[model samples]
Target chain A: MEDLTAVAVHTDVSLWGLFWQAGFIVKLVMVGLLGASIWTWGIILDKSLGFGRAKRAFDRFEQVFWSGQSLEELYRNLGDKRTTGMGAIFIAAMREWKKSFEKGARSPIALQMRIDKAMDVALARESDYLAARLTSLATIGSAGPFIGLFGTVIGIMTSFMGIAGSKSTSLAVVAPGIAEALLATAIGLVAAIPAVIAYNKLSSDAGKLTARMEGFADEFSAILSRQIDEKLPRT
Target chain B: MRGSITSSAIIHAALLGWGLLSFSAPTPMDMANSESMPIDIVSDVSQLQKGDKKAEKNEKPAPKPTQKPQTIPDAQNVGDSETDVETKPATETKAKPVEAAEAPKPSETPVAKPDPQPEPKPEVKPEPKPTPVPATEVKPEPEPKQEVKPDPVAEAINDVKPVPAPAETPKAEPAPQAEKPAEEEFKLPEKVAMPQAKPTPPAQTAKTPDRKETPEKPKTQTASTPSKEKDGIADQVADLLNKQKASAGGAKRSTDQASLGASKTTGGSSLSQSEMDALRGIIEGNWNKPVGAEESPDMKIIVRFRLTQDGQIDGSPEVSGTGADAGLLNAVKSSALRAVMRSAPFNLPQDKYDTWSTVELTFYPGAT
Candidate 1:
């Protein structure tokens, strides 16, 4: 009876014990699942913060772009400096307009087309930048559970082998192994659930931001086209 | 991006710290009770000593009283009759000559005479002889009787020479009076003869061909009835001893086996090897591999199921595997399923529900 109690004491079922005593395969599974979970959290954090910053930058750029400031003054304020998201698109439009003026193009239709083309290219680049690393989030979200399940399967297989080797069915003999196995699945879900949720939310947010930028570019081009039409008859 | 990386690192570190803290805390009450091996050994030894002392106290007194009725008559008449005559002047003088002249013939005839007589008569006569011996001397008789009986038997069985010496003494002391029928009333019956026969046969066999002939020669001697009774008693003694030794040896061996089983149980662990063996043994015991199934050592069926705390299956087990003939697979599946069902309500520790609540057993018949 004393020996029995001693055995019970020695076989501590703590989480650390479970991980420490787990077979090599099970330990490997746990480590992989943990890495995946941590990586998923990192992606989630980065995307959420990046999206918030982009929204603020877009708002600030829109205010300045529509502030009734002179076009050359706004262009010079932006200069050739690599600007924020919305500013980049505004700069691209202004550069094309200045080039058209320098070439002595008197046709407003040709001038408007070149300005729109430049802004469209700049808007595409900004959208691409906003959507960066979002695919990895999607991959992590989708693959997280499967990877966790893989770890669980391997851990359970190792546990069963331990049961077979010891020729024991006692819970003490198998509990630690099974607990370790389940931890893998738990970690997998931990990684996957937030990644999946954040992917859905951030991807949609990025889409909305892209549409807003495109809207800003369209309105800016319309404003430029209207000013050109107003001056064309006078010239 | 740098801020997000920093924040994520902080969160990861916090989770890791929480895990470490939980691990570093002392385990719950269930696991804290383990003692060292010396403590266990000390307790076990104390328990064993207590048991041994109790057994000695009980066993020492038991055989003494049971043995007295068997050894008393011969011991008293053969060894104490003369002493009784010398010590007690009144009753001894009155009973002495009659007892002395009567004792030899009766002792001589008891073996041969008793069996032919009704069995009931021999049993009644031995009880009276012990009642007549002075109480003081008879008290010491049992200890010596115990000491003497085994030595002669062990010597007879071992050396083969001491057999004749012991047998000759009894026959020679009563030889002249062996032919007399004057003491028929005082004759010892087959009851006394049967008990005496138990200890003497191994020695009797080594004495003479006459002893062998005595069993066969009893019928011829019966024509001279007195001698016939003598020969028959010798034959019964030899027969009884052989029978007793065979049975005694058998009893000893079975007791040895029982002690072996007790030792196996004594060393049992808390969640004992026997308990685990019982869990698996019950499941494996119920498994019946299908006849004509393809034999593969690696053939396995993995079964997963949840169990309630009391060990009842919470749901049907999920059986998965597909590597054998259809008939074989079905057989293996059903057999494994039956084993799982039959061995349920398992005797497991209720405290450790986290371990057994979900179980996945992989059955590999070839491994067993």
Candidate 2:
């Protein structure tokens, strides 16, 4: 009990005390920044995981797509989720090519033009799908530092004002304030670094996947056109 | 939308984790500040003495000579009644030879006069009849002594002399009158005329002794004031003052001497005021000034600590206005500790055990 009281008494007059008892406003600002940081990191991890899975899925889809399997078979294998995404784009353009050529008015060039337009629209749709929530991730990445900075500014301002009030110049007298300020900055960096890394990774993944989908759409349309030309009279 | 949901969750998680970590770790500054103690007590005693001396000397003019010319026997009475008074005239009438001989009287009265005299030896030169000149001269002698009370040997000498002279003079006067021949006593009714002069000398001496003793009395009154005399309570004050001044001078000299060494130790508590202020500015400037590597001001944190009996800190240190890096702060705390340790068993005057146990230090960076 004596030791505890001694320690408490020691702490009461210390810089640590000043920090613990920092104004309500300062603590609130720090708490708010912390919440923001936690939210940003959660977003970063979620995006990283989701984008990783999508990249893996997209890679697997491409392997099956390159195999000597029928387009209908690939479409059936994709099921619901894949069908509505990048794979759906390939299926849509192929289906369009088959329908256009099956009609009696079948010029290869005319059918190809029709398939190209269909593929362009499908590519647009796939890109739009990938683009969801990217803006929020970007916001988190860019804004993390400033949010942390806001906490730091508040902490520093409070610390210095405390120093002024105490009218002291010793490290012990002033340490808590400085530590709190640095803590805000450190927390800010911690929140921001991963957010930034995660955003960059996701963005690049989206770009790669979008490029591959566009290529697949064009190739699949060509494949469907070849199948239609073969079925028709040799010209 | 699915990716968006996941990404938002990730960002929030990261932000939340950091926030929680920050919240959990409450800085220990308050504890540290409370534990901090005063660093150097010896310096405070020396500093206060300097201030007191400076304040006293700055106000008062330099003390004049404290020894007046000794009183003289009446050559006029000898002339009126003594047959030998005629013999002394030829010596006096030798064209004011006595005044030139008495030219060195002021300097010698203060310096070499060991024996106490009955007659005012310097006053006997009746040729000039300059009684007022001697009186003014004697007052200057006592004034110099009041100034010297801050300096003991000189003050004691002044105190011892004047005190006895005033008391003895009156007793001696009546004896001188009774001892004189009847004819000369008749001619010199002057002794009866100024009967008050004898007792008045002792009274004048007693009043002047207190004036001379004021500087010494204050020292004993306030234990912190410096030296208190054993038998010489008055002398002790002057001795303490001188010792304080000497030690202060010695501290300055030793610090200068220490600065002569290579790689002068910085981050110590003994930095001068301007140096500490300048160091604070440096720390403030360096704080967050660097672009990438999260910079804080390089503070020269001087925690002026008073050491405990067991070598722990006695009291909470006083913190400076500026902030410092973690490494710098630790360095300063340890350096201040080392300084305290180096000055172990501090030479506090035994009487001032409580007061000299603690003092303050303001840290300065690069302040050798």
Evaluated with TM-score, which candidate comes out highest? Answer: 1
**Which pairs clash in the backbone of model 1?**
A4-B270, B111-B233, B112-B229, B112-B233, B113-B229, B197-B237
Per-model DockQ against the true two-chain complex:
0.23, 0.10
Clashes of each: 6, 72
lDDT per residue as tens, model 1, B1-368: 66765677789779877986676545556755343111000011111211232233332112111112232222223233453222334445444545455446646566555565544344324443542321222333333333344453464443343434445446544322322211232332222243342333222322222222222233334445756565566556544432221112211121211121222222222334454556666777776766643365546677777888788988898887566767777788888888889888887765444445676767765443
Per-residue C-alpha lDDT of model 2 across residues B257-341, encoded as one tens digit per residue: 1112122222223435554344334333333322311233334444454645443456555554255656655555565545544
lDDT of 2: 0.51
lDDT against true structure, model 1: 0.61
Question: In candidate 2, what fraction of native interface contacts survive?
Answer: 0.18
Error of 2 at A42 (Å): 3.1
TM-score per model over all chains: 0.43, 0.41
Q: What residue runs in model 2 are displaced by over 4 Å at the alpha carbon?
A: A1-29, A76-85, A98-107, A166-173, A231-235, B1-368
